[model samples]
Target: RVKIYEAMEAVILGADELDMVINTGNACAGKWDAVRKEISDLVTATPDTVHKIIIETCYLRDEDIIKASIAAMEAGAEFIKTSSGFAPAGAVVGDVGMIKQATKGKIGLKAAGGIKTLSNVLSFVEAGATRIGTSSGTSIMKEVR
Candidate 1:
């Protein structure tokens, strides 16, 4: 039920956090005003919840990524995340580094997708990612041991 809930609707239903993808095409085309408005609308609705804006870093240029990160933050995102995990490639160290630098620690960064190893986790952390989103948690724990 949670996964199927539309972003703001989920927050209304008591979700503590909301991570939803916007129309990435708009964001990628430098259409920040509309994208910002959309994201802000959700943020306004979820004032009590942690709203994460997924920018799909794999699909944008560094400048575009930075712009998306700032727009999301300015619009009230608690975090700016890198992928929906449906892209051919997921979070990369360079993308994380750029986002970290762009946000300047004002908002948290979540590095998700294709993160299968401890080193991959550390790389993102070192780049200022505050959260790691991965399906390989158990394997990462095993690698730590």
Candidate 2:
């Protein structure tokens, strides 16, 4: 985690003009109040970093998911991601919608996890996901073309 922050700081400072910082960590699962607070502090400490809280939605209850979304947004997160793909449920359209609804357009939404095909990517995009994280980016685009 410290290493990630160090890298982020380096990238932010190395660039002549830094655009945004997307914090890709599962800070939204189970009891995340403490995690949320820590992430919030990180963002506050690094005012240049635009934190994007990645909530692994698989392990969280619906209420917890909502709470985490709210917490991330309140903590100054610029985006809320659906999953990290290391959990049971993974990313789904419904989960994307839930995060979208929870954030109320205040933050961007990223849908990730098992997105391997063009259709899958389109599904997420159609479902209001502003960003698509996938290892199959090349294949998906090739398939689309």
Top lDDT: which candidate number? Answer: 1
Model 1 off-target regions past 4 Å?
A: 1-5
| lDDT tens digits by residue: candidate 1, 74-140 | 9998999899899888999988988888888999999998999999999999998999999999999
Could you give me the TM-score of model 2 versus the true structure? 0.77
On a 0 to 100 scale, what is the lDDT of residue 96 in model 2?
A: 82
Measure candidate 1: CA RMSD: 2.7
Least accurate 10 contiguous residues by lDDT in model 2: 15-24
Q: Residue 93 error for model 1, in Å?
A: 0.6
RMSD after CA superposition, every candidate = 2.7, 4.3
> What tens-digit string does per-residue lDDT give for candidate 2 at 47-92?
6555667677776667777777788888777777777666565678
Model 1 vs. true fold: TM: 0.92
C-alpha TM-scores of all predictions:
0.92, 0.77
